[model samples]
Target chain A: MATTEAARPIAVATTPHRRTRWRHVLTGSVVPRVILIVSCLVFLAPFYWMVVSALKTNTELAQFPPSLIPGAWAFNNFPDAINYIPFGLYTFNSLVITVGATIGAVLSNTLVAYGFSRIQWPGRNALFYLCVATIFLPYPVILVALFDIFGRLPSFGIQGAKSWVDTFLPLIVPAFFGNPFYIFLMRQFMLGIPKELSDAAKVDGASELQTFWRVILPLTRPAVIVVLILAAVAAWNEFLLPLLYLQSNDKYPLAVGLIFFTSEHDVSYNLLMAASTLIVLPVVIIFLVAQRFFIEGITVGGVKG
Target chain B: MTAAATSVKPRSVGRFRLGTLERRNLKWGLLFISPWAFGFIALGVFPILYTFFLSLTRYTGFRSPTLIGFNNYTTMWNDPDFWKAAYNTLYYTVLAVPIGVVVAMLLAIAMNQKVREVAIYRAIFYLPSILPVFAISFVFVVLLNPGYGLVNLLLTTAGLPSPNWLGDPAYTKLALVMIAQLGAGQWALVFLAGLRGIPIELYESAEIDGAGAFRRFRSITLPLMTPVILYDIIIGLSFGLQVFTSAYILTGGATRGGAGPDNSLLTYVFYLYQQAFQFGSMGYAAALSVVLFLASVILAMAVFRWARGWVFYGGEEA
Candidate 1:
C-alpha cells in the first residue's frame, strides 16, 4: 500500500506529458467504475431505504409498494420515536458504558503493551504470546462463568451495588482488563518507537513510569487514538454481554433498547426506522470523522495476522 | 541500554540467575502489566476453568450445584435442539464465511481500482459495517418484510419469487446470511490492504510475459492473498459460530428464546444463552460453552493445518 502511494507522484512527476493520456486511459476503462458505482449503490441501498422509511408517514409505510421517497416528510417521527421509549435514558446508559470502557481500554492496553514491548524481561516473549493466544479463545466459553462471577459480586461486599448484574459494571469493568487485540496493536506500535528515547529518559534520572508517561506515551498518540476509537465503537455496538448482564429496561443500552422498541405491539415502521437512524447516526459521524483510524486499526491488526 | 547490555552479555538461562537490573526490570514489567495479568487470571483463565467445572455440575443460579459427572454432556449428545442449534450454526458458518470472503475480495478488488472516487466508494462500502448490528437487524426487519419489504419488492420487480425472509423457517437462516454480508466491508478493508501489499511490479512483469489479467490474478494475486483469506476464514468461523444478536433481535427477544420460526435462527450461542438464562440450565449451558470452545479451537487448528498446503509466503518458507 505504501509503495503504491509512493509510486503515483513519481509517475506523474517524471511523465508529465503522459499524465493526461494516463488520465484519459484511466477514465476510458468504464467497466470497473460502473461495477463499483453499482456495488456502492447496492451497499448503500439499505441505509437510503432506512432514511426514506424513517421520513414516511404510517399510511405511506403501509402502502402496497413502498415509495422510494416518502410521500410526506414525517420529521416529527424522530422525536416521537424517542418519546415512545426511554431513548434518552438508553442513550445515557450507552454513553456511560462507552466512555468508561474507552478510558479503561486506553489506560490498560497502553500500560500492558508497554510492558510487553519496551521492557526486556525474561519470559516476556512467552507471556506476550499467551496474551495474544487468548484472542482465539471463544468469548462465549467464558460468558456463563463471567455471568456467575458478576452475579456473585454483591456477595463480595462492593459498595453502592446490589449485584454487578443489572448494572454497567459487567460491561464497563471488563475494559479495565486489557483486551489482547488492543494490547497486540499497542505493543506493535510501541515496538516501532526507538529505544534510545527511553534510554535517554532513564539517563536523565527518570523512573520507568516517568519514561513511559512523558516520553513513550506522547509518541504513541496515533495508536492510542486508534485504540480509543475502536474500543468506543465496540463498547457502543456490544450486544450479547450487555444483553446478558443488564436486566432492567431503564438500564438498557441503545443496542438492547432498540430491540425492545421493535418488539412493541404494532410497531410503527417509520418510528422504528427513525429510532434506528438515531442509533446509527453517532457511529456514522464518528466513522466519517475518524475514517483513517478505523481503516488503519482494522488493516493493521489483520495484516499482521 | 538494557537491550544493549543483554546483547553484549547474553545471560545464562540454565541456572536462571537474575542480576539487580534484571530484577528491577522484571518488577517494573510485572507492575505495568498487573492490570492485564489480574484480568487474565480473574476474567479469562479463571472463568474458562470455572466453566469446565460448572459443566460437570447441575446448578441453577439461585440454588447450589450437585455433581452430575458428564450427564450434561451426555444429555447434549442426545438432545435434538442442541443438534439443531449446532447444525444451524454450522450451516450459517459454511455459507456466510465463504460468501463473505468472496464478497470482501470482490469489493477489495473494486476498491483497488485507480478510480478517482475510490475513497468515496470505500467509505460508502464500509459505512454499513461500523453501524450497530442491532440497528441493522431492525432495518433488516423492515427491509425483509414479506409483504412490501425492499428486498422482496426488488425480487418481484426482477421477475423472481420473493420468499418470506424472516417468516419462513427455510429462509430465516438464509436471511441472516444476507444480513451478514453487510459487514463484509470490514474484511474487505483487510483484503484491500493485502492487495496493496502485493508488488505492482509482479503485475507489470506478468503483463510483459503476455499473461492475461485472469492468469495474473490466478498465479499472483490469489496465491499471495491466501494468508489473508485464511485469517478471514478463521476469524469468520469464530464470529459465525457465535452469531446471536441479529437472530436474538429478529426473533422477538430472549423471552422467545431467540429461536426464529421453527428454530431456524437458534444459533449455538443463542441456544447456550437460552439454556443458561432463560431455561435456568446453567450446567447444560456450561457444557455448550465447553463444546463451543473446543469446536472453535479445533476448527481454527484444522484451518491452520490445511493452510500449510496452500498459503504462500512471499519470501519465507511455508
Candidate 2:
C-alpha cells in the first residue's frame, strides 16, 4: 500500500509510456480488452450452455448447430429430471449427511482448535504436529481400513452382521471426530485472538470452557462461517464416500446421484445438465455469499482445498 | 487467581514439578481435544496401521482377511491393468500439473491488474472451479460429446477435426487434461492471493531502474510468486495422481465399470477404488494405496530438493 503510492509518482515520471498504456487500457485497449472479455465469456460459456441445454427440449438439443439459446425453455426439465431419477431422495439423503456432518465438524473443529490454541498444555506442540501430519495421509490408504471399521459399526435394528455399507453413518459420523484441515484453519484463526481477552475472563473466575464458548467462538464467527461453508460444500460434492458406502440409490448423495442420473438418462443432455446445475447450486451460492471468508480460509487453510 | 502466589516461573524453574495451574490447563486441554484424541486412536492411527496390515492379507469384504504375505504387492507388480493405471496416473499428473499451474498463474496475473470490476471477473473465473467437481465433469461430458457436442461443432465449423473425446483411448486423457485446465481457477485464486501480496513498491523501484514490464515481471513478480507456484504445483500433482470422478462420471462408470476407452482415464485412486469395491480385492487396493503414499512422499521430496535454490524466500536472502 505504501509502495503503490510511493511508486506511483515515480512510475508516472519514470515511464510515460507505461502510464499512457495504463490510461489507454483503462479507457479502451482493443487487444487486452478483447482478451479479457473473451476469457470472461470462456469461463461463463459452460454455465450458459448448462442452463440453456437444461432448458432445451430433446429435439432442440439434438440440433446439429446447437442454438446458442434454447428456443423453448422447458422449465419442467427440473421436475422431469427429479422424477426420472431418484434425485429427491438422493438430495434428501445428501442434505441429511451434509447438515449432520457440518454440525459435527463445526463443533469438533472449533472445540479442538480452542484447545490447541487458547490453552497451551503439555505436549500440545507434539500433539498438534500429530494432527497436522494426518493432512498428508492420503485418504485412499485410510479408506481401505475405514471401510472395515465402518463395516463393523454395529447395526442397531437391522439383522445380520453390521455393515456401514449402504448406510449414512460412515459419511456423517467422522465429522464428529474432527477434520485435520478445519482444525488447523480454526486453530490458526483462534491464535490471532488477543490473549488478554481469555486472561481477563480467567481473572473473573470464568472457566476455560466458558471463556472459549462465550469469548473466543463468538469473536471468531468469520472463521466458523468459513469452516461451515467449506465442510458443507465438501459434504455436498463428496462422490467417492457416497459411492463407496451408499450402495443403494436411495442413499446416494447429489454427487453420486448425478452420475447415476447421467448414466441412466444417457443422451438426455437437458435433464443431465438440469440435475448437474441443481447439485452445484448450493456450493456456488455459499461461495458467493461468503466470498471473502471462503478465500480467507483458503489463504490460511492452505491446500487441502 | 491464587496460582500467582506460587513463587515459580516455568522458564526459571529448571526441572520443577507441574504447577497446579499448569495441571488444570493440561486437564482442560486434554478434555477439549478429547474428541480428536479418541478419534485419532480409533480412526487415524488404527486405519493407517490396519491398512498396512491389510495390504499383506487377502481381505475380501465378506470373508475374514487371511494373511497372504507379500502376495497382494506381488500381484499388483505383475498385473497389466495396474501398470496401465500407474502409467495413466503419471501421464495425467505430468501433463496436468504444469499446464494447470501456468494457466492459473497467467490468469492470476491478468486478474491482479488494476481494472474496474475485476472482482466480478475473478468471481466468474472462480465459479467453475468452486462448483462441485462432478458437476463440471457432467457439464463437460455434454460439451465434449463427440459428434453432436458443442466443442466438436465449433471445431468442425473452424475446419478442425475434433477427436472422439471420451471414446478414443488416445483422446481420453487429453480430454481430461482439457477438463482439468478449465477448473484451474482454484489455484489461480491462490496465485492471485500471492500476486496481491507482492508490494507495488518493488515494481516501482524496478521501474525506476528502467526495467520493462517483462523484465520487472521476471525480476520482481516471478521470484516472489515462486513459493505459491510451487505449492500450487504440488497440490495439483497430488490431485492429478488421484484423479477419479471426472473419468468415472464422463465415461458413465455406473453403466460401464470401465474408466474410459481402454481405461485411459483409469487413474491410481480410480484403479484402487475399482479393485477394493468392484473387484472385492481389498488387499490389492491397499497395496496400491501404499505405493501411492510412498510416491507422494518421494514426489514432495523431489520437488523440495528441486526448489532448494530456485524458490525465493523474502527474509532469507536479505
- What is the per-residue lDDT of model 1 for residues B1-318, given as tens digits with 9 covering 90 to 100? 444443354465667888657877898999999889999999998999999999999999877778899999999999999999999999999999999999999888877776667788778878888888887887888888887788888899999999989889999998889889988887888898899889888887776797866897899999999999998898888788889888887887754444888899999999999999988989899999999999999999998999999999877973
The deviation in Å at residue A166 for candidate 1 is 1.3
- lDDT per residue as tens, model 2, A177-253: 89888999999989999998988887777777789889998999999998898888888888888888877666677
* Residue pairs of candidate 2 with colliding backbone atoms: none
The alpha-carbon lDDT assigned to residue B26 of candidate 2 equals 86
iRMSD, per candidate, in listed order: 3.1, 2.8
Query: In model 1, what is the error at residue A270, expressed in angstroms?
Result: 1.7
Q: What would you estimate as the lDDT of candidate 2?
A: 0.80
lDDT of 1 by residue, A242-298 (tens): 888877788888888876565657778888889889888888899999998888788
For model 2, the interface Cα RMSD in angstroms equals 2.8
Q: List the residue pairs that clash in candidate 1.
A: none
Which parts of model 1 have CA positions greater than 4 angstroms off? A1-28, A155-161, A303-305, B1-15, B255-258
